[model samples]
Target: MTGDNERPAYERGTGFLLARLGSLTARSWTAFLTEHRLTQAQYTVLVALQQHGPVGQRRLAELVAMDARNIVPVLDSLAAGCLIERRPDDTDRRRRTITLTGGGNALLAAVADAAAVEQDQFLHALNATERARLNHLLRRLYDSHIPEAPQPG
Candidate 1:
């Protein structure tokens, strides 16, 4: 029980605050990606490929923190757009190595500027130092919970 000056129980929860922030950011990201004819999953895969180089489908899925089962449709959509290539592995014919296409690289470069702008707008309240601290804290939390997950560069 609390006075009228006190925040509600839900407002005091870190999870609730994080979820609210996540929803708002996700909507902005989704809208931005939709304009580029891409989804979050597709963007994530492209970034992973850019960072890690050509990798097999299962490894790509793992790198993106996505289930192997769910990655197929995302890859299919990217393949349809010719944004990515899936080639048979040299050593293992059964394994398909996924690579970001030249087109994907171009698209990522084009959108990188816009993404930075949007991110700046979203965190306009924070100064550069504060933003860095926030990111560091978030990364620590992520590493603690998902130790196996690769840290995004």
Candidate 2:
């Protein structure tokens, strides 16, 4: 990877750097979340439910960026662990909503704190202002390119 060290700066494109960054972040998150026996996708579902309240499975899938088919197993794992509950939507019989249980909230809080440590370590080279700016730029790009996920009614 450092072969570019001798090459001109222009030779290494931003896309290549971005892909490397993505892999670095994923590995860091995987290590951190492993301690909690949670995958990043599972933690994502918990955090979304903790923040957004109960939501239909389809909406939860959208929120977590998981495919509609795959979210089920994550939900099942969480449900089996008693971290979440799947309740029938009162107004919509065909739909079910997922809610974080008290245990889930507690677990989420702990996991979030641990996750923050990983984030800090990963961005340690950046000063506060630069970190904020980088986050802002990423969010802007994501928001502009990705449509908002539909929310459960």
Best by lDDT: 1
CA lDDT, every model vs. true structure: 0.92, 0.88
74 in model 1: Cα distance from truth in Å?
A: 1.5
How displaced is residue 43 in candidate 1, in Å? Answer: 1.1
Scored by lDDT, model 2 comes in at 0.88
lDDT of 1 by residue, 24-61 (tens): 99899999999999888999999999999999999999
Backbone clash pairs for candidate 2 read: none
Give all TM-scores, in the order shown: 0.81, 0.79
TM-score, cand. 1: 0.81
Best by TM-score: 1
Superposition error at 32 for model 2 (Å): 1.7
Residue 145 Cα positional deviation in candidate 1, in Å, after optimal superposition:
2.6
